[model samples]
Target: MSFCLETYLQQSDDYEVLINKAGFKDCARLIRFKADEVIYVKPGEVILGVRIIGVPPIPIGIIENEKKLLIPYTKPCHGTSVVELPIDKKEIDNIRKLAI
Candidate 1:
């Protein structure tokens, strides 16, 4: 479960500083500070790091008939990027699993 910076960047259209698995689908703006960026996470939140995990196949439904399938639809599992504050043990575990 390695983290994928590119995917995370793409998913985070605004380049959000905070990204969590639970809110991955939802795009949120990031708050930057002179020391570092901050992303608010509630208690029991899960945050992963960037890394490459495995190869997963893409569904044909997502592919367009006329679209060029250049690169195999399969891609590695992408982890999320998050700030280190009030660090949660569980989030650390997930990041470790992803080798982030």
Candidate 2:
């Protein structure tokens, strides 16, 4: 399935927002600190149909037990947010391919 993060966030209640209206660096740190495993991707790499914005080697958090992925999402005026959502294996594999 093609997952649209924005649509999912708007229409579903299954996701978790770890932090909202925060800086990129702070969100990144929360991902690293909370997730079971951490991986890096380029700044503009797209995940869940959104372009991730951050410093070099942006962090993506993987929580194995919960089958969730933690990402720092940034918008024009909303600042950055750390969001966690359930992800399937296939999507996880796709994300791993973009790892730095």
Q: Which one wins on lDDT?
A: 2
Assess candidate 1 and give its TM-score to the true structure. 0.19
lDDT of 2 by residue, 18-89 (tens): 999999889988998998889899998889987888888899998877899998888879999999999988
lDDT of each: 0.28, 0.89
RMSD of 1: 17.2
RMSD of 2: 1.2
lDDT of 2: 0.89
lDDT of 1 by residue, 1-95 (tens): 65444455456553324444322222122212212322233322233342322122111111122221111111325433332233234544343
Q: State, as a TM-score between 0 and 1, how close model 2 is to the true structure.
A: 0.93
Clashes of 1: 6
